[model samples]
Each structure stands twice: as structure tokens, then as C-alpha cells.
Target chain A: MQKNYWRSNLKILSILLSIWFIVSFGFGIIWSDSLDQLQIGGFKLGFWFAQQGSIYFFVILIFIYIYLMNRLDKKYKDKSEEKL
Target chain B: MDTQVLTYIFVGLSFALYIGIAIWSRASSTNEFYIAGKGVHPVANGMATAADWMSAASFISMAGLIAFLGKDGSVYLMGWTGGYVLLALLLAPYLRKFGQYTVPDFIGARYYSNAARLVAVICLIFVSFTYVAGQMRGVGIVFSRFLEVDINLGVIIGMCIVFFYAVLGGMKGITYTQVAQYCVLIFAYLVPAIFISILMTGNPIPQLGFGDTLVNSDVYLLDKLDKVTTELGFNAYTENTKSTIDIFCITAALMFGTAGLPHVIVRFFTVPRVSDARKSAGYALIFIAILYSTAPAVSAFARMNFIDSVQEVQYKEAPSWFKNWENIGLIAWKDKNNDELIQYSSGNALEGVKPDFNNGRGLSGERLVNNNSDLSNSNEVYIDRDIMVLANPEIAQLPGWVVALVAAGALAAALSTAAGLLLVISASISHDLLKKTFMTQITEKQELFYARCSAAVAIFIAGLFGIYPPGFVAQVVAFAFGLAAATIFPALLMGIFYKRLNKEGAIAGMLSGLVITSAYIINYKFINVHLNSADNWFLGISPEGFGFIGMIVNFFVAFSICYFFKKPPKSVDQMVDSIRNP
Candidate 1:
């Protein structure tokens, strides 16, 4: 049961961190110029990701992690208690 | 009232408020002194963290840096904020569950080695001092310019105020005061940004206004900026000039460094629960994001306004801000063509980096600079990038009270960060070094007293750095981040995630990381200054980005050494499991 709980937590972390890497490093830096060919309002799409969008995504990602982790904590706690 | 008197009032009132908060939140015990009795609310801790994280560099100088670097500046925008994601997910909650007063406390206990703890303490002190020096110098700059006092006097005054709060209230005092500071600095930052946004783009929100069309123009603000800057022989304001690999490495270094910063990590320890650490990091990012996002918009606005106000204008017809900043030696104009027109094009206007001011007026009443004019370019102005944010309000002709508010805000930003760094330095000494390692017989009260004494001494040293700042203060600040990224971060990350890693592995990793990163930085930045360009950089990665390489070295050494050694004891494995469960 402890191993399962740890495994699930790692799974959540990997997924979120992947998204984090993609937004800032992938879009913002690697493909920024390609994305720059596109525009969002006045901002070049790549520039927006670099300065603004990635930060917003980071904030959202943390809260989502919080929601997921808190629920996971509750679920695991109840399961272990029932076994006890 | 005039700007100066109003500045005095605003600065005086803010100082008084900080002192009042300090007195009210005075820490009596070691627990309070070190981590605010572990009871700070998540939101308040978040606010404090935001203030502590955003230093004079963020509040006063960052927009200027962005204004000049153009799109290359996103490294800071992303690198500084993205680390919180790593912190929240990987480090903060686990560290909180580990339940430590200081970061070295975790290192010592987790690794079960005094040698590991001592190394962590050394890294913490080195990084914090390098960072705190920059903040102190920032205080001196703001005071000299706004309060019209001697820079030394300014540093002394800043020292006393910080000493009062940090010594008496400790982390408990600093946390509440930082919350207030976040309010003051953010308000000061946003007010001018909003005013400029309305003036230039007719949009109230600077973030949206950055993307909006200029007033009475069909051109988008960014498009206009891009066109103007490129026409003046500068890179397009929206384009990147740095190599992609360099940007990638630099951004990664800064991100990992931010997560590893001891002062910021200690903030998560102030919260009551492991979950609060996660939640507080989220709130801190939200608060930080508010300024971080607005900064780019302000950069665009300030750059546009600066060009429009100064370019091609005769020196005598220049805006009052031009002469005002010139009086303080931040902006210099040379009549390169004997036309007396400020032909603000691209490239160096003077032969050297900074202008050497002579004690005489120029042909157009500008301060005479002794540096020979560089004939390589037609640019006739030497404007310091640090002036961009500080001069933005006056450049836009904002109200006097708004200008005064910015002065106070700059002080708050500088002081809050200095206090945070000082507290951690004290904690590492009094908690990690004395009670935990050296003098185990010391009581709680003695530890508290030692904490205050160390804090007082740290403030004095920080003040000295401010008054007689080293010429390499700016470069060394970058080194602090790189060093932290290379040493402290990997040690903590592997300690939790890879339980097999033992003390020998951790120490070997930290030492190797530190040696490589510091050697690269000192070699390029100090010893081999002439060879500090892109061509000399290893793998086209500058010294600023070498921390990423250093971090990789640390991880590799740690893992490889661990394989050849005994596995960490079962008790350590269970400890990691418990932290993971929470």
C-alpha cells in the first residue's frame, strides 16, 4: 500500500513537470520563433509564452497539483485507516 | 507638496510602519526567531515570500533590463518564477515534512553527517551574502537619488532599520513586515505602469495594454516598438538575439537556482502543515506573477516612451528627466556630430562601459564625461539600463505623489529582501552551526541571543558592502544563483527522491558542483575578463548558464558514487517514505 501511494504520487509529478517543461522550454525557447510567426492580439505567440503565458501556466499547474495531491492524501488516509 | 518632501513623508511613514510591525511580532523563542513559531498563514506567507523573492533587482532594475535585452530577457521572467513549480512539487512539501528550522538542518539530519551540514552552511552563507550585498547597494542608490543624502548615510540608515527589525523580531518580524512590503512595492510598481499604459495605449491594464494598439494609431504597440528599435540599428524588440542553447541553459540554471535558494526555501518552513507549503508556493507565484507579467509591459512602454521623448530632440529641448538623471550621472549625452541633438541610436556612445564624469558642463548644459566618445556608432547617449524603472515615472510625467510612492517602494523592496537574507544567515549560524554542531550545550535562550547577535553582525557587513560596493557586485549576484543551483539544489532533490544516495555521495556531489561552477564564473568574470565573450564560452554557454552544466555534474557524481558505496540505512529510507506520503 505504501509503495502504491508513492508510485501514484510520482506519476502525478511526472505528468505535471512534463507540461511545465513543454510550456517554458519547448514553446517559449525551442519553438519560440516558429510560434512567433503566429500572433495573439499584439503579442507574438512565442513572446507571449516566454514572458506571460508560461508563468500563468505555472500558477495553474501548482493549484492543480495541490487539488490532486490533497485528494490523494485523503484517499490514501482512509484506505490505511480501514485496514487498521 | 513637492516630490522630495512627499518622498520623505512616504519613506518615513513606511519605515515607521515596518518598525511598528517588528515590535508587535518580536520573537521570544528559537522557534519564532527561526521559523515564526511555524504558524504563518499560507496567504500571508505567500505575500512575504513574494516580497522576499522580488528584490531591488525585480522592483527597480528588471524592467530596465528587459527594456534593453528585448526578448532575450524572458530567461529572467521564466527562470525566476518557474522554480516555484519545482519547489512546490518536488522540494517544499517534503522539506516541510522533514520539519527543519534551516535548510542545513535538513541536510545534516537527512545525510547523517556533520561534514555535509557544514558544506551546506558554507554554501548558504556564501550565496546569501552575495545576494544581500546587491540589495544593500540598491538601498543606497534609491536613498541617494530620492532622499538627497550621502550614499554612505543612506546605507547606515538602511542598516539601522533592518537591524531593529531583524534582530528583535527575527523571522516572525520579517514575515509580517514583508507582507506589508509586498503591498507597498507592488502598488508603487503598478501605479506608474497603469498610468503609462493609459497614456500610451489607452488601456488600464498594462498586461493587456502591451498587446493593444497605441492611442490614435493603427499600429500595435509591440509592432511599433519593433519597427522603431530595428530602424535605429537595434534588434527588433520582440526578437531574440541570444543563441538558443545559451538561453536554454541560462533559463534552466536560474529556475533550479530559484528553487534552491535558501532564503526562499526557508519561507516554506514558516507554514504549519506540509500542504500549506505547497499552497503557499502557489499563492506566492500568483503574487509574484502579478509583478512579473506587468514588468514586460512596463518594459515595452518605457522603451517606447524613452525613444519618443529623447530621440532626435535637441539637448536643450530634451525632457526634464533627461537633465534630472544627468545630474545624478546616470544619463550622459555627448555632441558626437556637434549638432547637440540626442541621436540615440544603437551601440556604445562612449569608449568604456560607464561614463567618467568631469567637473564641467557640456556644450548643451549636459554633464561633461571624460570618457572618449566612441566613433564606432552615431549614438550620442550613455543611458544606464538601471535607470529605466526608476526614471519611468518622471519620464511619463506621473504625479509627484506617485513618484514619492515609488521611492518608498524601492526602499521596501530592498530592505525586505536584505532582512530575509540576513535572517537565514543568522539561522544557519546560530541554529545549524552553534546549537546543532559546535556548542550543543547551548540553551534555547542562548541560541536566540546568538541569532540576534549574528543578525546584527550580518547587517553591519551588508551595510559595508553597500557603502563600498565591489565593482563586480552585479556579476557576483548572478554567481550566487549559479552556485546555489550547482550545490544545494541537487543535494536536496536527491536526498528525497533517491533514498539510496548516502552522505558521501551528497558531499562529493556538492563539492564537485561548487568547484566547477565557481571556477567557470571566476575564470570568465574576474580572471579572464577579456575572454568573457560568447566565443570563449564552453559549448557556447555563458558563465551565467554554466550552473546547468554544474548541476548535471553534481547529479552524475552523486549517482555514480552511490552505486559503488553502501545503500543508505533502512531508517533513512523510511524517513523518505514518510515525507513522500505527506
Candidate 2:
């Protein structure tokens, strides 16, 4: 049961980190020009992603990770208590 | 009140508050000294970490750098903050679970080798000292500008104040003071920005204000800025001219390096539980993001204000702030075309308009023309980038109190980071090297004494570096990220994730990464400075970008060596499991 919890935790981390990479490096830099053709309140979309949007996403991503991990920790605790 | 008097009063009050906090929270034990007794609330620790992480460079220099770099400056905004993501998800929780006092302590214990610990300590000192030099210089700059003190005297005053709190109260004092400093610095940063934003765009929010239309014009603020800058022969405000590969490499390097920085990593150790450390990192980012996102807006506003206000004005009719800054040798203008007007543009057109300090108040109007050598009309004004943030309130015609607040905030930013780095330097020497490695028989009280002594010595050395800084050390601070990313980050990350990463592999990886990164930076930046240009660069990757390459090399060497050689002991594998599980 603990092994399963660890595996899930790793899975969550990998997924979240990949999303971070895609938003910051991928959308912000690599495909920035294409996305920049559009506009958000006068900011070039790609430029906004690089400077403003990506940072906002990073904050949200971390909080989500924190919330999810805390839940996982509680689940592991309850499962261990039942086994004991 | 006079600006000087206002500055003195504000700076004095802040200093008194910091000293009072120091006395109130004096550390009684090594635990308190190293990690604030590990009793700090996650929120308070988050605030302290924000103060500790955002140094003088971030406070005084970042916006100014962005003002010139334009779109290229996004690398700093993204790169500096993105590392917290890596820190929170990959490293912070695991390291906090390990429950170590210092970063080197973790490296030593996890790798089960004192030699590995020693190498980590060497890297820590090198990076921290280089970084603190910049902070001390920042302290001097703020002092010389506001209080009218000599730069050397400013550094000494800064050194003494840092010593009082850092040595007396230790981490406990520094942490609480950092919380206070965070408030002062962030308020100081935002107040002027808000005023300028409202003035420029009729919007209160600086971030939104930058994208909004100008107060009277139909065009967006950025669009207006782009038009004006290009007209003056500068790059468009929203477009970047740097190669994409270079941008990608630099941003990646900075992010990885930020995750690896020891002073920042150690802040997580102050929070109690692994869970708190994770949340604390997020909160820290929220506080940091407040400023990081605001910086670009401030940059754009300042850039537009600077050009519009002074670009083609007569030298004699230049703004009072321009003349005052000229007196301090920060702004210089000459009528290179003998037209008695300042024509600001890009390039070396202003190369010959030297400021004559012989009259003791800088070059006055007639003297400026008499001393001018060239006939070029394109460039006649030279303004230093460091002045952008400090001069913003004056240029915007803000109140005296706001200008004084900027001085206090710049000091707060510099002093807090300097204290944090100085503490890390002392801890590595006293606890990691002396207690753990050399003098293992020392008592707790004796260890505390050694820590204090080492801290004093470190501050003195940092002060000396600040006063008569070697030219190479001036540029070395930029590569602190590169160095930390290459040497320390990889070792710590592999020590946790890969169970088979033995001491030999870790050591080999760290040394190779250190040597390769340092060689690349020094060869181009120092040994053959002319070869540092893009055409001569390795695949056009600048020194700042080489850290990512170095990090990859570190990971490759460690994994390959571990595959061929002995795995870590069963005990070490058990330790990894314990760290991971928690």
C-alpha cells in the first residue's frame, strides 16, 4: 500500500513538472511566435506567457501539488492505521 | 522635510527596528543559530525567504536591466521564479525530511563521505562570497547616493550592522528581521511603481497599466513605447533581438541554478515539517511574484519616461534630476554637434561627452561643449542603468518621502541577502568543516563560539571584496547560478533520486561539472575577454547558458560512473527511502 502511494506521488510530480515545462519553455519560448499573433489586453500572447502568464501558472501549479500531496499523505496514514 | 533628512530618518528607524529584533530573538543554541530552532511558522518563513532570496540585484538592478533589454529581459522574470517550481516539487520536501542543518551537511551525510562534504563547502563559499560582494556594493551605492557618504564608509557601516544582527541573533534574528525587511522593501518597490503606472496609463495596477492605453493616447502603452524607442534608433520595446537558442539556454540555466542555490535551499530548513516546507515555497513564490511581475511594468514605465522627458531636451533645460544625477557622474550629456541640445540614441555616439569633475559639481552647460570632441548629433546623452529605479521617483516628480523610502528599501534588500549569505559561509566553515570534519570533539558552546568567529572573519573578507573588488569578481556574481547549478544541484538531486549514486560518482560528477563550467566562463569572460562574443561562443551559448550544459554533463557522468562501479551501501539506500517516503 505504501509502495502504491509512492508510485502515485511520483506520477503526480512527473505530470505537474511536464506541464510546467510545456507552459514555461514550450509555450513561452518555442511556440511563442505563433501564439503571439493573438493578443490579451494589449500584451502579445507569447510575450505574456514568457513574462506574466507562466509565473502565474507556476504559483497555481505548486499550490495544487501541495494540496494533492497533503491528501496523499493523509490517505497513506489512514491505510497504515487500518493495517496495524 | 529635506530629502537627505527624510532618508536619514527612515533608514535610521529601519536599522533600529532590525537591531531591536536582533536583541529580542538572540539565539541560545547552535540549533537556533543554524535553522532558527526549526520553530518558524511556514508563513513567516515564507516572508523571510522572500527577503533572503530577492537581493539588491533584484531590488535595484533588475528593472533597470529590463528597461534596456526589453523583451529579452523576460528571461530574468521567468528564470528566477521558475526555479521555485523545481525546488518545491523535486528537492525542498525531500531535503527538509532529511532534517539537516546545512546544505553541505546533507551532501556529506547522504553521500557518506566527508570529502564530498568538503567539496560542497568549497563550492558554497565560492558562490556566496561572489554574491555577497555584489550586495555590499549595492549597500554602498544606496548610501553614496542618498546619505552622501563615501562608498567605502558605506560598506563599513553596512558590514557592522550585518555583523551585529547576524552574529548576535544568528538565524533566529536574521529570519525575523528578514520578515520586516520584506515588508519595507516590497512597499518601497510598489509605491513608486503604482504612482508611475497611474500617471502613465490611468490604471492603478502596474501590471495591467503596462498593457493599458496611455492616459491620453488611443495606442497601447507598449505600442507607444515601441514607436518612440525605434524612432530613437533603439530596439522595439516589445521585440527581442537575441538568438532563440541563446535565450532558451540562458533561461534554462538560470532556472536550474536558482533551484540549486544554497542560501535559498537552506531557507526551507527553517520551516518545521516537510509539508510546511512545500507550502512555504509556494507562499514564498507568491510574495516574490508580486515584485517579479511588477518589475517589467516598472521597467517599461521608466524607459518611456526616461526617453520622453530627456531625449531631445536642451542641455541647460534638462530636468533637475538629470542635472543632480550628472553631478554624481551617473548622467552625462554633451552637445556633440555643438547645438546645445541632448540627442539620445543608441550606439557609441556619446563616447566623447566626458563629464568634467574638475569644478566639483560635474560639467555645466558651456563647459560640456568646450570639452566635447566629436561632431556626431546622434548620441549626446549617457545615462547609467542602475539609476533607473533609484531615479524613478524623482523623474516622476513623486514626494520626498517616497524617494527616501526607495533608499531604505534598497538597503533592506542588500543587507538581508548579505546577512543570509554571510551566515551560510560561517556555518559551512564552523559546523560543516570544523565540527563535522576536523574538530569532531568540540562541545556545543565551543561550536557556537567558532561559528561567531568565522562569521566575523567572513564579513571582514566580504567587506574587503566590496571595497577593492577584483575586476573578475565583479562579473563572477552573474555566474553564481551557473556554478551552483553545475556543482551542488546535481549532486544533491542525484543523491536523493538515484539509489545507486555512490560517493565516488557524486564526487567525480561535481568536480567535472565545476571544472568545465568554470573553464568555459573564465576562458571567454576573463582569460580572453574579446572571445566572449557570440561568434566565438560554443554554439553561441553565453556563459550564463553554459550551466545547463554543465548540469547535463554532471548527470551523465554520475549515472555512467554509478552504472559501472559500486552502488551505494544498503544503509545509504535505506536513508534515501526514508527521505523519499517522508
> Which one is best on lDDT?
1
Clashing residue pairs for model 2: none
For model 2, how big is the iRMS in angstroms? 0.8
Q: Which stretches of candidate 1 lie above 4 Å from their native place?
A: none
Q: Per-residue lDDT of B1-582 in model 2, one digit per residue for the tens? A: 899999999999999999999999999999999999999999999899999999999999999999998988988999999999999999999999999899999999989999999999999999999899889878988988899999899999999999999999889999999999999999999999999999999999998999999998889988888898898888888877788888888898889899989999999998889999999999999999999999999999999999888876877788888878876777767656667677888764444444444453234453343344344446777777888999999999999999999999999999999999999999999999999999999999999999999999999999997788665654786579888999999998888778888998999899999989999998988799877888988889988899888999999988888777778889898899899887
What is the DockQ score of candidate 1, to 2 decimals?
Answer: 0.89
Q: Report the error of model 1 at residue B524, Å.
A: 0.7
Q: Which consecutive 10 residues in model 2 chain B have the weakest lDDT in total?
A: B360-369
The TM-scores, one per candidate, come to 0.99, 0.97
